[model samples]
Target chain A: MYPTKYHKPASIEDAIAALGGGDDAMVLAGGQTLLATMKQHLASPSDLVDIRAIEGLSGIAVRGGSLTIGAATTHAEVAGSGDVREQCAALAALASGIGDPAVRNMGTIGGSIANNDPAADYPAALLALGATIITNKREIAADDFFTGLFTTALDEGEIIVAVNVSAPTKAAYAKFDQPASRFALVGVFVANGASGVRVAVTGAGEDGVFRHAGLEAALSADWSGSAVDGVDVAADGLMSDMHAGADYRANLIKVMAKRAVSASA
Target chain B: MTKVNMNVNGKAVSGDVPDETLLSQFLRETLRLTGTHIGCDTSQCGACVVHVNGQAVKSCSTLAVSLDGADVMTIEGLANGELHPMQAAFNDNHGLQCGFCTPGMIMSGVDMVARYKAEGKDLTSDAIRAELEGNICRCTGYHNIVKSIEDAAAKM
Candidate 1:
């Protein structure tokens, strides 16, 4: 990896100032993806703004039927937090299932969502649960937040302060995990939240994480495993990889949708 | 060079390292503690697992500078002249074959078991398998590795 400047700010304001100064800087969250990309020489930023030291950026809070997870909160913390488990069991389960024990313990929610890897599990949950991403600039809805593959609505100087996800009536996440890296081959998150029935699928679609409107409509009418049995997600733009074909992914979407509904029940 | 301060094995140590210096490189090079191995530069491999603030994290994916003032525990810090309980269990259960992935496996397993015990929950094979899903072991096929974690949990 090429040498670069490392700045550890005493506060979030200082970090923001460092970022605002016109330099190609990458906010070092968990470094799970960023560091790997750097080592591969895919991304050579001029500076790294270490954000781990910023106090109050790591926590889980539940109030008024809303669960707010701090940006820097590790996946392990989300999985282990009684507040998260009690409120959003699907989110906790998703966090617990991400990568392995080490990855879960170290990787942060902010980093995971910001990276927005096609196969990442959190994106599915966030979208299905109608989570709001509270960044330094503004709060963006989950649907609007994720623009495209590996793309978020965040500006260059913006930082994710926390994610405010409303509690759902019933929700569950299911994934066909890839063998080697444990990333999702086709992960589905099903939720009947205050915003109504929502279904989000990750890893299977070529467009990255997306909502299955047909499945959502079917399940919204009748929230049951069998409700999703005959619904076929279009394979037109689904991913075809060594692990699974596009048709296979489309089929798995229905299966996972059913399983998610069943699991939540 | 970036000047950073970190606590390793309960010792406060400060050093100057390259800005791009990985936590694994810092441990092995600057600190001269080579117990943590880097199997893959990518975060996919758990060969460089370590505890940052008592939680297991892939050290190779982290920067030495990012760990300033943070507590770290490597495989070298797991024991003092004697094998850690998890290490002993792995030996007795034949958890390691090539031994290349042992340190990471042990580090991750220690955190899992400790967390399980703290939660007052019983550790099962399924749970251990789920927990060890991140650490890759090409040799043992994970049968004995899972058993070792269970045995260690029982002893604890």
Candidate 2:
């Protein structure tokens, strides 16, 4: 059974205080993934700090060609926001396509990225868009933020306040979704050469979501589907599961990168 | 336990609830609003669907403490005594059989229709079906659910 004392903090300071109380405290944002994990007894926190009520923590804003999204902003808001749909259609599309409606409505970008499910979609967008995760303490680049499967650079007691993404000139995400779960079997996000064509692959990597340097380099040369053609990805660190093998995932990296490049073009 | 205060169906309600208590449990157990059902403990199932601040959310995945100062609208509050247009259409189009999933399905359906109406866009069957994908029903195969939402669109 889930064990926790629910605490609603009026401020970020209070929320952090709860986290530092020497208990296994989990920060609850949308709780779309966290609660489900709790229900399955995958996690048993001594305290749950609910931060949704904390003011000034949920919104979307575009300033100076950078999109600053509050950590608590739900997927539904991101997908349906007028600014997001117009300025970053690819991001909106990715948000809209994440799990079914309930998940979209309750799942936040911070929670999803923090959970770092191998098949999640946000990590690709974060890596490709060159987003900076703003926490209570500091800002970390997306490249350095994600460490491994279900791990991040975030230290305990640090809460993600917002995500600031330097808007891409053009971008697109394409994913081969697992039918039942709707999680990506192979998801790819490609941005234009302004950022030198960063390509982040999810669902196929053993490390959860990671940038494909080879594909990025190839696409930097030519921003087209043919750029990554015949360029094989190394299967050394690809995930092998009931869904697909390591070699198949490696192959899919190339295919998905090519498709993303073409779609963005 | 946490003391929670929120607007439910446009009325303010306050109560003390446990941190481990899901919004679904609060609505069904404490408040005794049984319209919202819990089909799965996981967030994957939308049987416990409810409107938290005007958006359809999985009640099972949310905590009452998180919604302390938010606005919530459950399936119980969808209509004013009489059935909403979506409810009427669901009945007319045979949108349900087992009826276990009807409450959640109808709540999501009405929310989608309201959202589209606010945007001044006509609701299409595809759009309605896409939004309702969060809600699942074991019966009717979703054939009539789609038809009911479409029919409800016209009536609205």
Candidate 3:
């Protein structure tokens, strides 16, 4: 890692101000992804604003028909949270399944979503559950939050405060984990809520986490795994890597989507 | 340089190191506590696992400066001049071959047992194997390691 200045901010306002001081300043939540990237020389921020000391950025609460999780809340907390398990078991399961126990103890939901890794698990859940990304600057809906691979709509110096996800009537996530990293080789999150049925696919999209409109439409009409049986996910515009080809990922998307729907049911 | 003060193995230590210094570096270089090994610096290997505020975390991926005032327990702290229960179990069960991943595996196992005990869950063989995902043992093929953890869980 390169030489960098570290600032521990006690409040969100101070964090933002510290970030503004350096053009290449980056916010450090759990330091799971950022630290690894820095170690690999992929990223070198001039300043690191450590926001873990900030009081209000780490917690989970259900309020007004939505489950609000602080951005700094660790995956372990979410995985073990009774409120989350009761309100959104799929979210809890997804949190528990990320990486390993040690990683889960350190990785934060905010960091995971903000990094917007294409193989990450949270984006699919956020997109399917129609969560709201609440940042210090503004509230962005999940639909507009993730822009592309390892990208988001967050602006420079913008710090995510919390995420508010409306409780779905039924929701579940199924993932085919890559053996080594445990990241989602292909993951699908299916949800049925007030808005309608939503199916989000992660780790398989060429651009990034995207909703499967075909599966969503079919499931919306039938609300069953068989509804998506005939729907074929296109291999074009899907990710292909050493672990899986685009066609294999397309098959995984269907299989995972079916599993998620069955689990939801 | 960043000034950091934290409790390590029940000892309050202070250091002024570069902001980019990892917790593993601080423990190995500054404090001379080499028990916390760095097998894979990419955070995939659990050789650098340690307890920060009673939770197992990858020290290689954690910044030392960020842990100011926190309580850290490395493998060296697992016992007080005597073998801890988990360490004894490993020895009795021949859990290690190369012994490179022993410290991390033991730390993670102890932590897993603690967490399971708190949750009132049994530390079954399946649970031990599942929780040992982070710690990679290339030599042992994890057969003895899993047995060691299961043995330790029983006594712990």
Candidate 4:
């Protein structure tokens, strides 16, 4: 990692100020991915404004048929929250399966979505659940928040403060994981909420997390496992790598979607 | 350089280290706590696992300077005169081949057992295997490691 000044900001205002004061400063949430990226020389920030110490940045609250999770809240916290379990069990299950226990301990929901890894599990959940990414500047919907792989719509000094998700009536996430990395080879999140059935797929698209309209339409018309039988994910824009071929990923996407649908149903 | 202060194994230790210093480096180099190994030096391998504020964390992935006022525990602090139940169980179950991953394995085991027990959840062998996903024993000695954790969970 390059030499950088570290600032432990106690408040969101101080954190934003610290971020704006430096040259290429980055917000350090959990440092599970950022630290590794820095060590590999993939990123070198002039300053690191640590936000986990900031109060009001870590908690889970369920109110008005929605779940508002503070940005700095760890995956472990969300997975163990009784409120989350009762209100949105699928989100809790996704948090529980993110990585190993240690990774989950240090990885935050804010950090995960902000990084927006192509194979990350949170993006699928966020997109399917219609989550709102609340930043110091303003709130952005998950659809507008995630721009691409390893990229988000966040401005240079913007910091994610909290994420608010609408409670889903029925939801479940299914993933075919790459054994060593635990990243999804292909993952799908299915949700039946106020907006109707939404199906989001990750780890297979060349453009990062995307919604499968065919599956969504089919499921919205008939919410059942067999509803996905006629829907097929094309390999046109799917990612192909040594781990899996594009066709294989497309197939896995359908399989995972069916599994998620069945689980939710 | 930044002045980092934290309690390690009940000792109030402070040092002026670089801002980029990892917690694993702080423990092993500054405090000479060599029991916390740095296998892989990345987050993938949990050889750098330690207890930060009573929660299992990969020290290599955490910044030392950011952990001010936090309490940390390592493999060296697990025993109180006698071996900790997890440590003794590891020995009895022959859970070590190279002993390279034992420290992290034991640390994770103690944490999983405590968490599962507190939640009133059964720490089954399958559950232990799932929770051990972070700590890797490349020696393929997971069978004994699982047995040791199960045996230790019963006693814990």
Candidate 5:
């Protein structure tokens, strides 16, 4: 790892100020990904603004009919929260199945979405639940928040404050995990909510997590596992790696979607 | 260099180290506590697992400077003077062959039991296997490890 300065900020304002101070300053949340990248010399920020110490950045609360999860809240916290399990069991299950227990203990939701790893689980949940990503500067709808792989609408020095997900009537997620890393090979989230039915697919997209309009339409008409059976998911623009081919991912997407719907049902 | 102050095992220790120094490095090098092995520099292997603020975390992936004022418990801290219950269970169950992953497995098991106990959940065989996913044993195929944790859970 390259020589870097570390700053533990006590407040969000101080964290932002620290970030603005350095051109290549990076916010450290849990350090599961950032520290590993630093170890590999893939990312060498001049300064690391540690935001784990910031108050009110790590908790779960349900307010005004929406689940407000603090950005820096660890995946373990979400997985273990009674309120989260009661209000959004699918999200809790997603959090619980993220990485191993240790990784989940250290990795934060803010870091996961901010990095926007194509294989990440939160993006699928966010897209399916119509979540609002709240940053220090502005609030972005889930559709607008995720731009591309490892990309978001967040500006430089912008910090994710929290994510607000409206309560869904029913929702569930299913994923085909790559055994070695436990990353989603092809994951699908299905939801029936006030906004109607929504389906989001993660881990198989070349362009990152995307909503499956076809499956959403089918589920909107018929909320059942069989509704997604006839929907044909194209292999085009899907990720193909040594783990799985694009065609296999397309097939797994359908299977996962069906499983998610069935689970929710 | 960054100044760090933290409690390791039961000892309050402080040191000044480079910013790039990982918690594993600090424990093994500065403190000379080699019990916490670094099997994989990456976070995948749990050989470097330790309790940070009472939560199991990968020390290899965690920076020492980040743990300032935090309480850390390594495999060395599991026992007061004799073998910890989990350690004894592993020995009795022959959970280890090469014994490379024992420390992490024991630490993770102890932490898992505590977590499940707090939640009023049983530390059943399936639960132990699921919770021990982070710790990898190249040998012993995990059957004995599961048995060991089950034995320890009963005693704990």
Candidate 6:
């Protein structure tokens, strides 16, 4: 690991200032991924603006018809928050299932979405639930927030303030675990929210998390598990490795989607 | 170097170390608290689990500088005058083989029991196993580990 400077800013402005010029400066939220990446020498940031301790950056609240999870809020908080459970139990469940207990205790929703790991569970839920990522600079819809594998619309020095979502009428996430890593082999998030029915898949896509228009249309029309059974999921652009072939992943997509619809219903 | 302060193991401790120093490195090297073992430092193996403020977090992956002015409780802090209930339970149940992962397993077990009890949720054996997902015993000695957690849950 390379020696770098660390700053624990008291406010968002201080954090952004600490992330000066932002090319090699990174905001350290939870540090679950960033610190580990640094240890492996895969990332050598010039400075890390520690955001988890910032007063307003860690919380869970439900106001009006929305649930806003602060960017620095840990996964354990989301998994255990009564407000989160009441507003979106599926989101809580998804948070609870990420990594192991220690990982959840340190990993944050902001960090999770920012890294945008291909097998991560948050992107699918955020996309299917139509979440709005509230950042210090601007608000980006989940649809536009995620661009591709390990990529997002975020620019340097842009700190994610919170993730806001309108409480869904019905929502559930079904994921097939990769076992060793506990990452999703093929996960599906099904929801009936403000945007009507939206279905998203994670872990299987070569381009990262993606919304399934076909499954969404089917679920919007029929709203049942059996409605997803006949949907054809092509393996053309999916991920294939020693863990699972793209063809197998395509089949699991439908299976998990059906399970998600069944759970949500 | 980064100057950090913390109340570790019920004592006020501070250090000036490299900015990139991990919590596990600080505990083992600077503080000479080798009980918090580091296995698979990539954050997969939970051998370095410790309590930051109150929750269990992987020390191997957590930066020491980020925890300035925080309270850190490690396996060494678990027992005050006598053995902690979880440690005793691990002993009674023979929950370890190589014992390299024992500190983390015990820390995670204690935290899991506290959380479940606070939530008014039952600490079933299945729940214990699920909660231990982060801490891996490469020896695959999970059966007794689960039993130890259940036993400690009852005693705690």
- lDDT winner: 3
Stretch of 10 with least lDDT, candidate 4 chain B: B38-47
Residue-level lDDT tens digits of model 2 in B3-114 = 8898888888888887688898888888888999988666665788888878888888887877778899998787888998988999999999989888888888878888
Weakest 10 consecutive residues, lDDT, candidate 3 chain B?
A: B137-146
User: Candidate 2's residue-wise lDDT over A1-265, tens digit each?
Assistant: 5658877788999999988883698888888778888899999989888787788789999987778889899898999988887777889999999998778877899888888888899998998888899999999999999899999999989999999987787789999888778899999999873466788999988888998888888878878888788576899988998988988888888888877777773
Per residue, candidate 5 scores C-alpha lDDT tens digits across A202-264 of 999999999988898899999998988889899999999999999999999999998998899
Stretches of candidate 2 off by over 4 Å are: B10-12
**Candidate 2 DockQ, CA atoms:** 0.73
Clashing pairs in 4: none
Model 5: DockQ score: 0.80
Looking at candidate 3, what is the lDDT of residue B51? 97
Q: Tens-digit lDDT track for model 1 on A155-183?
A: 97899989999999999999998877788
2 or 6: which has the higher lDDT? 6
* Residue pairs with backbone atoms closer than 3 Å in model 3 (clashes): none
Q: Please tell me which model should have the higher TM-score, number 4 or number 6.
A: 4
- Candidate 6, position A260, lDDT: 88
Clashes of 2: 0
Residue-wise C-alpha lDDT for candidate 4, range A87-200, written one tens digit per residue = 889999999999999988889999999999999999999999989999988999988988887889999878899999999999999999998899999999999998788899
Q: What DockQ does each candidate score versus the true complex, computed on alpha carbons?
A: 0.81, 0.73, 0.87, 0.82, 0.80, 0.87
The Cα RMSD of model 4 versus the native structure comes to 0.9
- Error at A250, model 1, angstroms: 0.7
How far does residue B102 in candidate 1 sit from its true spot (Å)? 1.5
- What is the C-alpha lDDT profile of model 3 across A211-259, one tens digit per residue? 9999998998998889888897899999888999999999999999989
- Chain A of candidate 6 gets a TM-score of 0.97
| Chain A TM-score of each candidate structure, as shown | 0.97, 0.97, 0.98, 0.98, 0.98, 0.97
